[model samples]
Target chain A: MTRDSTPGSLRVLVAKVGLDGHDRGVKVVARLLRDAGIEVIYTGLFQTPETVAAAAVDEDVDVVGLSMLSGAHMTLAPLVVKAIRDRGSDIPVVLGGIVPSQDVEELAAGGIAAVLGPGAPADQVVEVVRKVAASRS
Target chain B: MIPRHNGGVNSPRQQWQKAFDESRLREGPFQTLSGIPLEPVYGPDDGEYPGQYPYARGPYASMYRSKLWTMRMFAGFGTAIDTNRRFKEIIKAGGDGLSTAFDMPTLLGLDSDDPMALGEVGRCGVAIDTLADMRDLFADIDLGRITTSMTINSPAAVMLAMFVAQAETAGVPRANLGGTLQNDILKEYQAQKEFVFPPRQSMRLVRDTVAFTAAEMPRWHSISISGYHIREAGSTAAEELAFTLANGFAYVELARQAGLPVDSFAPRLSFFFNAHIDFFEEIAKYRAARRIWARWLKDRYGATSERSMQLRFHTQTAGVSLTAQQPEVNIVRTAIEALAGVLGGTQSLHTNSMDEALALPTEKAARIALRTQQVIAYETNVAHVADPLGGSHFVEALTDEMERRAEEIFAKIDEMGRGSILEGCITGIEENWFQGRIADSAYELEQNFNRGERIVVGVNRFLEGNDDDDLAILKITNEDEAKQKQRLSKVRSDRNDAAVRDALDRLAKDAVDSEVNLMPALIDASLAYVTVGEMMNTMAGVFGRHVEVPTI
Candidate 1:
């Protein structure tokens, strides 16, 4: 977490990192976090992992969430994490959208702080982000 | 058994009232779950019949009795050969039509070897780069006999050209090919977002395809103007109807501007819609779509042929409506949605598999999804009548309401384009008006679900005893990517580099001249073994790429 970021005042960057343009879920989640009094920086569709990581560090957000519905999570999620690490930032990364159950464990072990599926409620989504953000702090 | 009523003792109305007063009904609150009030009986409102002008009842007189809707299942994943096996399986299992789903890379005009396509190739759908892959995609399938619908855009020209080239190599004349190309690009900027060149340049490609198909392929549907993506992107039912028809009108105007006759191409211009939940709403949307298209084609576009006015469409059970929790319940959801599509007078239907929310469907799940449509066609008597809900007061009123709302949207779009729908669509895409509206709808619906105003079974409510772990999901291995890259490399090595370069150069040259239809050049390029990426790159050099300004 950034030194300037306070406890109650958290920030999150939500992005769609890949060729998938299924933004219905990601856009809704962005608004959900915004309505929960958290600052949300949505780096819109077709973002590369490096760009997303760069934006996260430039914004100095508390957490980053990637929405992958194209079934490329197992391959892309780790790349995003590696990109963030390469940038010397250990910000917590959250994964959402259509992740199969068997891959959830692997993603969690691969430094994905959380994996929210399609049926995740708004409060649960908000709480998960908050918890991940708070853990980093 | 032979009891007869007294002819003069009692009036018929009095006898009905006596029976209604004495008969016991089911428990109270006889209404739809959505709170729409239901009447015990409904009398006919309008005397409109099927196969008429402004077809609100149905498109054809004998809807299902004459010919049942084609059960078209969408199948694609991994390499072209993998999808070919599935295609054969579908045909052998009695599927009448084939709907192909292209991978994201192919959809975006990228080859499997492109860095942007890493980890994404063959994950969502099949990967096709050149004519060789296209040949493998339809191996053993008779292109002349069976109709194929390719769910592709942006690079639709390349894919369609590849199809035509493959058919030609198979000794099938281009005129004998029967299929549909989902070459609708306006919706890409608005919803699906898999776009390449700028809107005007992309329109030129679409125009070229429309002209080519109308002249060469008589039985082919040039474009399946789509609302499935609009609704999937979270637009309301009326928004989907209005936007889809508006895009359809835009295409019509584009073809007309290109000097094509309205009756020549309008008959083959089809529609694809999403059959979401809310059964009556979906049915009414379909009815209103047909009515609006008919009136617009006749009154607005000045079409003389009835075929141009008749609005025929294909329906797919909403993929967005599938739930990951209690995944098996999706079968029931699909069945109801498929029923709605049939009752809405759809010409064809595709039932979504239960495991879509988690992953692409496994073979067993895909079979069950197909069976869902079969059950609707064979077992249910719903197919026995044409628009069986036509005369019901509730449905009729809903249909009218949908039409009114859609017209209001159309008027707004017209105002945006200064009385031209095509210009209005271009302006709307530039302004992100449609994207914003759909995003707002999606957000509102999510709020409703979060607040429990909407009940998604096993998601927000009925959360007990649900275990999705036992459900098996199909996985696409990374080896498909390796194999596809190898095949692409082999094609590049085997083909004459000079011929490929010349063909692509011709395509680029023709793309610059608006008067020239680029289809012949594209077919030449495909025949020369120029890849989709290579051809699109050459055109992009002339037309430039379209980079969208993000909405959210």
Candidate 2:
């Protein structure tokens, strides 16, 4: 509805994927993004690939961020991206939470634009998405 | 009398304070942990009698005088058999109830052999992939005599059935069994993501429990609306109470919509909240929860029964707050939190073990946690009095302020809309930076603690380099998973192949059809010995899998 039109105008949709049931971190990121002048619509938790993709398309969002602290990310994230791709929409899906260092490459290869680790600062998150969003344009 | 100014930009804060005659600040950020104005005086009118408005005092008239809160030490790790052994031990230590915590795979509704369940079958809590697992989980415990609480969310209905079936197998009639299931799915989405089905679908399962349990298992608390995870995720006491109660309202609304009588089922609806480090704030939260829930059930939901109004909750000390550094300090922290849960009038409580930050608790540590509860129950005279802080000016003022703060958050959730709590909008409220700031503050303040500016007795100030010397962690011993897989494989192999095929086909058909409860077919499939992952996979085939929307 509104845009700051700064060099980096970020939009984030923080979500919980799979059956982990931990969304507190995602909630924190959403708040941090809003304060930073970004449009954030969290899809809540237990989002199916179909619903997540539908929201991404319906909202016309640039960045789709998934929050999965559960080890199910490797399995769940790919399905979400495939759902997006199946719809013929090209959007970068970033992930955050208790991601092991070893799993980062696999997640990225699975079409995750990026993976932010546990100790990621709110500012770094903003910066990463801003760059990713700007590149999409 | 001076006029009171509501906490808004319209009225100046000074005028409001003048009206209340509340006093100066303590602790950083210019407020008490409860965010109430602290006065340096005492008076008679500060708190109401026990069971009065604001519930800052307490709910029950006698409080702990008549009966102590159920001491539920939430313990379980490894496979079902191992946890079964551990449960007996916990009971022997004078613990009163069983509170189960399922492992990742079980929480995910996957059987142990599922490829997705690799390396994480029994890490966090007991793994129960099938009815057989549930039977072993409680092998010898008399299900009818002792109450059990399961900390499960997404697949709670299925597990509840497994529990019911287990009790049946134990010869305890379904109606006779009593316990709680943490069927708080909104929290599952809002905080914990260990969910199976999509929101609307999962809500259906929730409806099934509230509907089925209302008629069958009268003693079962079908859903424990949870704020425990919210607080553990770094929410303030006020947010914890407000969001949790809102979710509770959402559930009540769902059950009513599902055609279940409001009073009939609402009575069995329970709450689970977190007892955090802030003592007065926590106490005020529990107090406010009772008042708010009672009022809402009567006014909004048309709940006529008093049983429907009473917001009975279980409390656990904040797990995220436990520190890894000089971990013994967690004991004192847990003791204070447990006391807060007590003062807050928890119906049941789980105190965290000291070694929680490092790993699953050692026996010595878990015993210490149970003993902590016992010491409070027996040795301390605190249990004798009802609402010990009933008349403190600070606590009363805090109770009011905290309630007001939560109402504001609730108002925001209302602005977005209400209903399934799945409206894709509740997520926005959590993201409102509403609860997020707490974590930012805690993480920031932790630096001060590290730098010795903020003093924590054993962690930062005290120096003990040899603290790590030969500290033995409780390691899970035994091939429970292997044995479990072997049994499951044989069971699958030996079952009538055609019947299994027909049952699955029927289950898939039931799932694809719109508005079907699917519980009947699900229970049938279980009766036919369908694996957890296979049944869930069948549903996943029909419902399709949940996709993750990226957060920018």
Candidate 3:
């Protein structure tokens, strides 16, 4: 309830899609956004794109951040983005993990609003999320 | 105690002392990165010495002098044929053993051709759908001579069945087949979320595999109780040690409850740990693990054999510690972590390649990672002596602290289950207790790094220009995925469909009875050329799937 007090708190849904179990980055980002006075909902590991997109609509979050370390991003990112689109929510989806540099353009083309690779600072991530959420709003 | 002074013009220590008086160090007392306090110097009375019942010193009397730790780089990617060629190359490069990293599909018990496995077939690791792939995986390599370690958990039993079937077809007796299965399903719930079945049912499969290996595959390590993934998932060293040992204890209890003698199967049990960047902390954690495991096995479990009390573990340099910013610095980070593992007495070590933070290791990077171990083994004198830092007051104190914290954690976990480890772990997992703790630690660390209180060299502290263009990363193409699909299709068509169906039916029938150990049926299915996915699907029908309780 306290999260609603801050103006433009930018409710964000952090989702882990596919069988990739690496959630350290996503959990860290969730805490970071929550600390920055943003409303955060974390969908725990092993989530399907359908489930993630449905949760985004049901929760009506302003933004969605998807984290995956397994190279299933190409296959999974599109599904989640399309699912959110099909649900008629223009929520910006941010991606993070150990993504290769070459895959950046392709992932961005697949509707990833921002791509944060490994070692991206928390402040930079927050700034990107805030900027994207503002644009969406 | 007074500082020692040498009667020279000026000793290096004396110069530093004078400079400290003239200038200043940090504002106050110095501590380890993990917040362990540091005294100016160390002497006796820190803790017990290495060797003996609680083996803080080392597992064996002659640690590396008798035999150096096996250099087993975790390598697998693309199709089985591709990985098999890499295996031969590694053997030719003088690797002592093999460590297999299966692809996401194979790891999660999905066929290569499954719709869920699109674009993930040969990306992370090698794709092995059936016995035919396993046959190609170890094609030219002699199974009797080279011991292999597989990093698979949920479907470990099926993979082991396939391995056994492959070896049998190759005329290698089960007695001669030696390898380790990372069959640590508990950690799957705790940290690495690659699990399929529910917790209690997953325990059944783990128990069945451990029981079967204790009897039939005596030479094989039934399960490698892994703390590596736990630490990588952002647990502190103490949590990693305590949680891993608790899981180990639970497995031991489960096996004993299944009517197996402790000593008979305990010796075959092994451990796997992560060598994080905290050099002294990692060393102390390993030492404390050995001592705690030895004492627990002896006193708690009433183990008389020394072999049963010894804790043998494989170590891998922490991939989480690697940086994508200045990838070259990862080489130094991995070497330091590898050194810590060696000093801490790992039975085998896998140093991560520098490029792993970006992509799967390129051949040159993997080779350099292997050479890092060779340099440590031959050039460095650290291996000549066992527990070389055994008597250091700092190390001993840290080791004692680690053991103390682990005991506290054990007490909490025990309390959770009403003194039953198996029950407590199940409750702890279901309650998201472990996940909560790890998330807290990870969040704290991230906050520290973000605030510049904790510094990662290339990432936060030292700024460097862009120069990663020359770094060649290994890429798996759509062709690789298509080839793997074709291979799986061929295996499906080549095998006798009726025989495979019958074997799977028998497996499904046997799986319902708690009294039946499922390994024999699994092996039968494997021999009948039942795919890994088919075997797991039959069991999943009985066991059901695992859905995690959200923590954050």
Candidate 4:
């Protein structure tokens, strides 16, 4: 709504990438981003990679922030990445919430930008989104 | 004696006191967890004689001396038969009541063979897809004698019907049946994302149960207006209390609309709450919740009876507080939390097993969890008195503070309009409110622990290693799914197909129409061996799905 036409800042999508409903952190991050003047599209709970990817292409979002607390990060993240890549969007994707430190490297190897775990504050999320958005530009 | 006497108009000190009238300043967030200002110290007269409402000084005068709270340990995993074995084990361990947890598929009213239930059958809990599985869930467990509480909601009516049908077949009369159904669907909209029907239709089913129970299952709770899932969904104690009670009112409103007398159903209404690790905060939350509900039921709703005002509740220890790191530490956390629930006056409780963070509780871990409760009941004198922290200045103030803050949330929900809370919940605002508070508290605690200001034994101080030895976890048997599927298929093929079709058709009609209680129809369908999945599939087609847009 604002005159700022920045792509990443314009369309931010928040998703619970898998089965986990522990959205406390995700909700907080969404609020912080919204307050920071970003458009947030939330894709509810229990979203598989296909639905999430289709949504990414549909919404034309600049980033896909997948939240996983179910320890299914490995199984879900790669599928989402592959689906996004197959869509040929070249969208920069970021992950958050309860993905373990070890899986961060693994997810990065598979082309997920990064996975933010617990204690990563709202400010840090905004910073990462801004950086990812700027780099995309 | 040089006693400092007051000087008024001219004295500098007196002028400073007058500067209170002249003082030009305003400040910030006025509530504290303990309801205290930044007052460095406390003395005699801050607050006292803060009598508990709804008989809070103790619900009943004699308290535990007259009645001990029911030891209701929660259990469910693998197949219904497997869970039944655990139920027997729990009963043998002196569990006074039963609380069964259904698996994801069962909770969502899906059969084990449904595509969505593929690998998830009996994953989080026991699978109960039909009357056969429900029968197996309570095969030897005496339902007539012991009270049972099912944690399944969306398909609760179907499950209850199956339970009742099984019981009657076992020669247990419907009149003698006793238990509670956690039928609070509002929490489903916000916290637990498990609802087959839309909110309005869900309330209708709940109303039917409320009405049905008043006639048939007199001892059964029509609904346990729950704050547990809200807390688990990252709401604070106050938010949980407020939102949960707001939901209670919403249900009462629907029941009233359904033409049931307020007192007829209000007496059967119960509540479920979560007792987290914040010792005093949890206690105050409970005490405050009782007071608030009692007041709202009488003053706000114009209910006349004492039973209508009383807020009876069951509690479960916090499952979210457990850490996969040094999982044994969870036992201590559960103990303290269980004590909080006890001290707070929970009518019944479900303590989490230590290994629940990783997998379902192993039999050994479940036994230990039950033993933790046993120790509190028999060894520790914590339960010997009721409302032990009732009159403490800090506790009382906290109760008041929680009450005040919760009222604000309730007001906000009301302002958004009753139906609007569900949509508001979908929007990031309400979740943001919940997440903001939790995030702030969690961050403060993390920062404190990291800075060595607040010690958390193993994590930040007195660091230890190798907690695996402390856990003897119950592993899930892969055979559970196959066994459940086999039994479910038999029920599907062996029943009166015409009856099931008729019931499902009627349920669809009621759902399509204006708000209609679908419980009776649902029960009828269950009687005809309509699988949980089949029933939900009917509704899912009509109501459509609600997407809880991600928050942060």
Q: Choose the strongest candidate by TM-score.
A: 1
Interface C-alpha RMSD, model 2:
6.6
How would the candidate models be sorted by TM-score, starting from the highest? Answer: 1, 3, 4, 2
Q: Highest DockQ: which candidate?
A: 1
Candidate 3: interface RMSD equals 3.2
DockQ of 1: 0.49
Q: Which of the CAPRI classes, incorrect, acceptable, medium or high, describes model 4? A: incorrect
The C-alpha stretches of model 1 lying farther than 4 A from their native spots are A1-8, B1-46
Q: Each prediction's TM-score against the native? A: 0.93, 0.74, 0.91, 0.79
User: Tens-digit lDDT track for model 3 on B477-529?
Assistant: 87988998888788788999999989988998998997888888988898888
- TM-score for the B chain of model 1: 0.92
DockQ each candidate and list the results. 0.49, 0.11, 0.47, 0.18
Q: How well does candidate 3 score on lDDT at residue B336?
A: 99
- What does fnat come to for each candidate? 0.74, 0.14, 0.68, 0.25
DockQ of candidate 2 (2 decimals):
0.11
Query: Which 10 residues in a row give candidate 4 chain B its minimum summed lDDT?
Result: B40-49
Candidates' chain B TM-scores in the order shown: 0.92, 0.86, 0.91, 0.84
Tens digit of per-residue lDDT, candidate 4, span A1-137: 11223355557777765445566656666666776788877776766787888888888887888876544466567778899889987777888765445456878998888666644545677889877767776
lDDT of 2 by residue, B414-498 (tens): 6656433334234543354333444554444544543457665444456475255244555543365566677788777888778
lDDT of 1 by residue, B215-299 (tens): 9999999999999999999999999999999999999999999999999999999999999999999999999999999999999
Q: lDDT tens digits, residues A41-106, model 3?
A: 888877788889999898888889999898888778888999999988898898899887888899
In model 1 chain B, which range of ten residues has the least summed lDDT? Answer: B8-17
Model 3 residue pairs with clashes? B50-B57
Interface RMSD of each: 3.7, 6.6, 3.2, 5.2
Q: Please report, in order, the local distance difference test score of every candidate based on alpha carbons.
A: 0.90, 0.72, 0.86, 0.72
lDDT of 4 by residue, B1-552 (tens): 332424434433333234333433333222244544432111223221112245444344334544568888888888877788889988887888998887777887778997556556786788888777788888877788899998878777777777777888888987789999888876776677676676665655676778778878888887988889888777768878887887888777777777877888898888899988889999889888888888888877778877887788888999877665577888999999999888887888888988665556778878888888888876765654446676687998999999999888877766666444444333323344544555455444444544568555454455458343344545454477788888877877888888888988987897787456666677777777788888888877777755543433
Of the native A-B interface contacts, what share survives in model 4?
0.25
